[model samples]
Target: MHIHTPACPCFIIPSSMLRKLAIQADGAERQRLLEQLERSAFLRGQRAASGLAAPGLLVAPGVRHRTVYDAHHGTRLPGKLVRTETAAPVTDTAVNEAFDGAGTTYDFYQQILKRNSIDGRGMGIDSSVHYSKRFNNAFWNGRQMVYGDGDGKLFTGFTHALDVIAHELTHGVTQYTVPGGGLVYDGQSGALNESMSDVFGAVVKQWHAKQTVRKADWLIGAGIMTPAVGKALRSMADPGNAKLTWSGDDQPGTMRGYVEGGDVHTNSGIPNHAFYLAAMKLGGHSWDKAAPIWYQALSLLHPDATFADAAQATVKAAELRHGAGSGEAAAVQGAWHEVGVV
Candidate 1:
């Protein structure tokens, strides 16, 4: 049996936001937004042809091989090498940010999760910064991370936020870790894929800042957007606050809020909040307990698992890790129920 997964680029900025910006802008700005929309469509077509985002390419083992490339404000990829694993910092901020962001993401998975790298194979982490002129998005292009300077209106630079980098890279992590090779990136499972990235993205930031559940803001892509777009792209702590700064969040905290098999990023708010609730109830560093349980649950998920199935899997994962019927297990169950997923 084969699942027709939406083999598409995982972008930090959702299409809806971009479309809105495009419709509202004028003159040169509108043209740039239209160009971005077209580029995104083109990328989706490429992914559909390629089958996998990160294709099966064997990488050297043992070394934390990392490289940063400069796109020079053009569309070309894997551009000029600007930094390496052992090089000095460059004058370009985007170059340094991509370099440092990839390194930090690698360290989090390596040190906290005990995973070697994106593939757990010590595979090299690479990134391309300043991709295309005023590109308004960042994404895991199936093989590498690409950043845009953002038009400075709706969005700012992409590399400044650790979680944004972590979120995109975690898509690579899922490409390697999910059961049956990967989850079909469509419908409910597609939403779950987005949610998983959000889960780890928030955890990475929390883990790095040494923030406990209460202290963590649970905001994704925070500080990447201009002050005009609100506080952040998404809020796990309160999904309804996802678009507080823009047109207001449409994310619902329950299955009733599901948008008719719509945008994965929007539908993800339910599960995002579920993870937040469980982590909050568990009351500790997200990485220490919540992340491990969610990670373990990732392996158990059916490739096409629905919201109910995922909720059940998390409950099972918690029970497996913290003993059956334990407080942790109850918390997982309670969290799902709170989010109306159970």
Candidate 2:
């Protein structure tokens, strides 16, 4: 069945956060925030106009094909081609970061999960850096990655952070992996979409660092935002902890504090925490078991799958992989129960 899925770019920084920061700021900073927010909205419209992907997708066989473009502080996407898969590092930091980050994310999926590229085929990875002047976000536009250099005060730069890059790219992974073109970007399903990105984003970062679950700092988008704004975007280990994240952090670790109509990024903390709990309980490298189980669960999920559905899917994935009464299955179920999902 061909689902006409609207193209909603998954942004690394949520719009709500930008709005909150804008409200707190004044003069030029506030104006900049508002302008960026406007740009974000405009981009969403532009993506919709560009059209969504039709079902029954086809791509090249699984081979790592990466390319980086320089947006040159303009709005146009897949801008000036600067780097290719075989090219050497360029002088521009953003270009190099985009190139390398995409490569690392691709490697993590291919090597760790034994999956191909984003589409489970050899789909080319394209990234554009320096998109718009002092733009404060990075996003996967259902096709490629686009990043903005931060306003220097609020955000440093998008490409510098590995997890931020991985998070955005994984949105593409989720897009092609999930049935019906991708999870609908709202409510519980949207939260699951965001959580999927966060899960693999954390896993990729951990795998890159060779860090165990205990050694890995369960933070996303670390060092992207200015320290004054926050430590990171969210804390999987202790969601909703403002001190660990930022003053504006309001993610709930479990269902008791679930927002009635929360932004996907906000409610994602529930499943994000569940994944963290599962990984910790499994007690090893996150990529070892927790991540694979989650990866497998993607194929078993529908686009509108809820938190409860995801909980069951992961538990089933565990049982399928390790056995009906295995430690993996028990841990997976326990993790969901702890999060009040099942």
Candidate 3:
């Protein structure tokens, strides 16, 4: 699904009366409100963790599995399985696309990364298709990857693209490894996480298609958008210039125009640009060298890593894998400097 725009109101404000009440009151009232917000956030995290804590449905032992549901193509969430372990035949193109995308992601992890599943523990791969009628965004939801058949105007089914599927699944990998990592879904750290997912997402696609760096498009969600929509979600090669807007431009390529604090997806363009530059500078299939360095940086580094930290980590990985003054190390350093990551 394509969330061209944010699904929810994006922000919330406390009642004016409550704010005024707290301002007038002493310590206890303000503390109570603060505590409430903290508690609410904690509860939400707990609930998401609980959902992901167990395997949703085991279709097979390893990462390969398939199942389908009608989804009724409406605005209701998939609450429970209408039928379990029953194969709802791939009746349409959308279902087939989802199945293929899921299998591709599973294979990428198993063969390339050697990760059994999202958590590297042979966790079940679960997906719900035909979700909410006209639901525009596909999400991991901390458990299953849920797909939506688009409104048919701006987007088709999200499952059409393998990279998008892998992208969502990588979010699970981040959660397990960087649990409670202080990369608030905004600013540099948030951008790093977003870029990390894209890096792996594109790598999986490249590995699956056997495309080299010189041959890859380096664009995420290349096929998801319908002919009507003018652009893909975001471009790693060129961030701000990826789309032409009806109103005005959406992103700023450089750090000068970078919005320091925003949602992870929007602010991610900075680091994404850095990765693209790094891959191009390395001058080979992205998955061959650049991807491994980045993966090692992500899995081994601190959770609160910044762009500079990531740059250094890649340099370190290159030095260890190649040599201190190797071409890959120099390319990584140059790319970060080009993007102002240093």
All candidates: TM-score: 0.94, 0.96, 0.76
Clashing pairs in 3: 2-136, 74-133, 213-285
**Best by the lDDT measure:** 2
lDDT of each: 0.84, 0.89, 0.62
Q: Candidate 1 versus the native: TM-score?
A: 0.94
Worst 10 residues of 3 by lDDT: 3-12
Point out the worst 10-residue segment of candidate 1 by lDDT. Answer: 53-62
Off by over 4 Å in 3: 1-52, 55-63, 66-70, 74-89, 179-183, 242-249
Sorting all predicted structures by TM-score, with the top scorer first, yields 2, 1, 3
Model 2 lDDT per residue over 1-342, tens place? 766343477899999999999999999999999999998888777766765543223445446688899989998877999998788999999899888889899899888887778888777888999899999999988788999999989899989889988898888888888877778888999999999999999999999999999999999999998888989999999998988888999999999999999989999999999999999999989999999999999988988889999999999999999999999999999999999988
- Ranked by lDDT, the better of candidates 1 and 3 is 1
Which candidate would rank higher by lDDT, 1 or 2? 2
Model 1, runs deviating above 4 Å: 1-6, 53-63, 242-245
Residue 307 lDDT, candidate 3, scale 0-100: 71
Q: Sort by lDDT, best first: what order?
A: 2, 1, 3
RMSD of 1: 1.9
